[model samples]
Target: MLKNIVLLSILMLSSCSTDRKVSDKVSIMLDVPVSPIKTYFKEHFDFESFIAIETTDSFLVSDIKKIVRSDDNILLLSGNRSVFLIDAHSGKLKVCIDKCGNGPGESKRIIDIAFNEELGQILLYNDFYKLLVFDLKGDFLSEVKVGEMYENVTCRRGEVLFYNKLNGYSCYPYMLKIYNLKNKTWRTVGDDIKIDFPIRSRGLQMVNSKRVWFNAPLDYKLYCFEDDTPAAHYRLDISMAKLSDDLIKKSISDPQTFFNEVSMGKIVYSLNSLRETENFLIFHSNQT
Candidate 1:
């Protein structure tokens, strides 16, 4: 019970460096969808056409994790190992960045990838190993050595923001951090983070225009990295579906038992990814 309280304590209604705190009163109870996902999206979202990427044998993209769009091209991160640049209009593969090594312009392991609008380059993090930059044509540009282990990556112009998650295998403490490409200086947010998230490994950070929005797992507060600092944007109160530490430990060792309990109508909080639009706030929860 005590361990549960200390876990994810960095996101426990503390005021941020921005000195802005969202009211906890603004909570939401999500309703389980009775309808299928296709039906739900069709009814709720506006169709703005579809994109079909041409599959080819040359670029065998497997385990594609993330896709970020530019004005003309889209950058795809696959297996967190390689990056593929594709034409957004033609859906053709433009270039592929998959050089593996410890030498110049190479990555030992890509922790995450994001586009840098300021330099018109791609920032590939080698999991606290190195920061490799490349042009859209897959040409190697430069590298910056970094020592922080961050999972999710997003950038705006000159600032690269990261959502740091200290999992059972990691010891880096900050929940969020910002790296300046010019001077290579750093500013951390939620350095008090010391949570040992066992079930979840990856953290999430979604870029919307100029603001970067993210959420802490099993928690309700929505955070945004705006003005170079972390601010609590929204507090999604699903206090009713409270998470249990005993259940978490049990689920780690015996998932079947946990699923069985949930099948028997056990209410547990297991929300992970978060995304916000101009009008709607979207999230994924385990209850449904």
Candidate 2:
């Protein structure tokens, strides 16, 4: 009778255990400050629409060479011999004709532009293998000959991350990059950091302080780099991809309203933006 009772108790416990649900929770911490970003815009030229190159001469002072949108302001590198500081909102030109460095190779190509948000300066690399550093006000700080790497090197999130290509290899290991401004010498992230994807990614982004996200070209995966090392990552599942597609479609459909919404709320920088170009590099911060 005692054996029978014991067997019955064991069966009951097993049934109870089978009825319980198992849930796995992943805790992801965000390091970037989730605060409202106050944007100030000063237009370099008068364009009918905002946040885009205006076709009209009134807005097109020169060619739209390059533009970088940061937390504080927009750095405009135009065809004219200078750069401009535009307010993030209102599109007003806070400072104009702020010349630091000339266009590369007779105005053919402008290499890479890096914004040092902490230092309140923008570093511009030209085709002539020269690096020009300028304050937000457009004041020239210094210019140095940077060699071949200057043309290919790209920065993500200011000076936190830097990337360039390897000689003679355009395929696997076609990329060489580094992180943190304190170090100038570039070191490849890790060995066997293979990204099996289609299109080549542009650059890396500091997703908060601890995590760095890089797009796998032609693939939907976001490669995570932790502590300047390759890490485990995942592709954007269909649902997340759909959500992102919707957001982008909304922006293209109605940029004004979308920009307003982005300005009014906390703007999480898009990982897609970093993938828009082929020369995009990688970056990370220390917060996380």
Candidate 3:
């Protein structure tokens, strides 16, 4: 019930829109007015049933890298070294899969995670192109070998989509690739893209059990995959032309400076994550 309340509250706040422009196109356009954080938080603040995770002997969390909510449980990945499946309501530790070795279901460290709610399984991954599958209870199921090292991954229809976020520095040319488990085949989704994002993020945003949205740290338009192709989902009400070609080129060649410039408001800040309600979508931008 607490998880439900938190979720409801987040969705409720995410529906805020001080201003908007309606559209009848296939891709809906939402214009949200940027308001001050102090006013916004003061207006929507709630002190009921907030969640706080405690550090334990078995689990010492420097940062929660990823999180997925299912039923009354939460699957969390911490610092890409520990994975925990805990009770969402009581905050009790259910299972901590921290097996780091060279065994069959072991890795040097867990780098990423993807939840297939439809399949009811968890995929623990590493940067070396490996997958450690586990059930909801954290039992090791099997190990899978992927062709490329993926920075972000999400599953759909028994297929796992991989985004190679190497920023064109790697040997691989394509940015997005899909691997079908049933057929044991591989296919590229889009053209070669090499821009690297500065902020720490979850590359793909899962919307319900059907849609997934994607955008880089500086990308102008958020994209959704349709028929394995990325289609424009929303226009961020920001001008893409304000971003010069030199900056785009630097995003790949030199990411640190690009991150610095973007942080100092050298250009239009980019949106990172999205939360949706019935009518409006809320985004957390980098600087604003």
Candidate 4:
């Protein structure tokens, strides 16, 4: 009788284990619906109608490519190889830097521009791997030899922030570098992330005067730096519209196939250009 009881107990235990396994499998196979994420934009801000500013006779811009805002002036980069500093309010031409030759303070192609308030200088980057410094009055200050061609550049607190294309390939993880005008030294940052593909244009912006923000061309997250150190800050979440990892890999490897799939409305892609303000973070993406 005892032996019979022992066999019966073993059978009961096995039956219970089988039931638990079946229950777990059912739970794993259950379908759950995810809630959609909601985004809100501020609508309390006031809006003003546009008023066109007439171009003065002194300020002759052939084709304005880009404009940067200074204290009370606007720096206009024209396609005709000219840089004009004009008053923002009066529409008067303050100064124009149009030195297009193979000599000093001359640039074949202007890549980017920055303003240094403390030194009262304007920094212009050229295609020939040169950083030309000029006074606010359009006088040539000095020229520094840059190692590689940079697509975008900005200056703040006497330091120039730019990404060196040569270093991006050689230095796998470090893509952004800072050049100090005080000591004339280069320091690398952005070491936490690694980019597999070569980025032609990097997104680097100075938020006010103290912090700097950057985002890779293909990345969804934005990074910020305060005094040369990464700060704990905000992150963007578009997982609701993000593509699968397999699809992202395929897109990078086989762009033609990815484009075809996107054209057929089979894939969803996220934003590339990211910008932020005190109240809002703006980006553009494609949805189907």
For every candidate, C-alpha RMSD to the true structure in Å: 9.9, 22.3, 8.0, 22.2
How does residue 206 of candidate 4 score in lDDT? 29
- Candidate 4 lDDT (Cα, whole model)? 0.56
Please provide, for model 4 over 1-288, each residue's C-alpha lDDT reduced to its tens digit, 9 standing for 90 to 100. Answer: 111100000000000111010011111121212442343332422322222334545445666655566666667778837887766665566788988886999988887787776687888888778899988789998988886765567777888877535444322222456688777777665553444443233223223222455444344444455646534244454444445566556665886776676657633343333455555454444443
Give stretches of model 2 more than 4 Å off: 1-67, 77-83, 95-108, 144-146, 149-160, 164-176, 179-186, 192-212, 218-220, 236-288
Instruction: Return the top candidate by TM-score.
Output: 1
lDDT of 2 at 60: 42
Clashing pairs in model 1, backbone N/Cα/C closer than 3 A: none
Best by lDDT: 1
Q: Residue 253 error for model 1, in Å?
A: 7.0
Which pairs clash (backbone N, Cα, C closer than 3 Å) in model 3?
none
Instruction: Please give the CA lDDT of all the candidate structures.
Output: 0.62, 0.42, 0.61, 0.56
User: Ranking by TM-score, best first?
Assistant: 1, 3, 4, 2
- Compared with the true structure, model 1 gives a TM-score of 0.77
Q: How would you encode candidate 3's per-residue C-alpha lDDT over 1-288 as one tens digit per residue?
A: 222212221323221112112222366565655444567645654444454555565455557777677667777887867887767777767888887787877778776777766667888878667877888878888777874666667777777777644534442223457666557567665556454444444433333223556555555566666655666677766532266678767776788877787666645645555555455455565554
Per-residue C-alpha lDDT of model 2 across residues 40-145, encoded as one tens digit per residue: 1122212323443222333344555555666647667676355666666545566654333344222234555657776787776666656666666666666655
Question: How do the predictions measure up, each by TM-score?
Answer: 0.77, 0.46, 0.73, 0.68
Pairs with steric clashes in candidate 4: none
Error of 2 at 44 (Å): 31
lDDT of 4 at 278: 53
Off by over 4 Å in 1: 1-38, 167-174, 201-210, 248-268
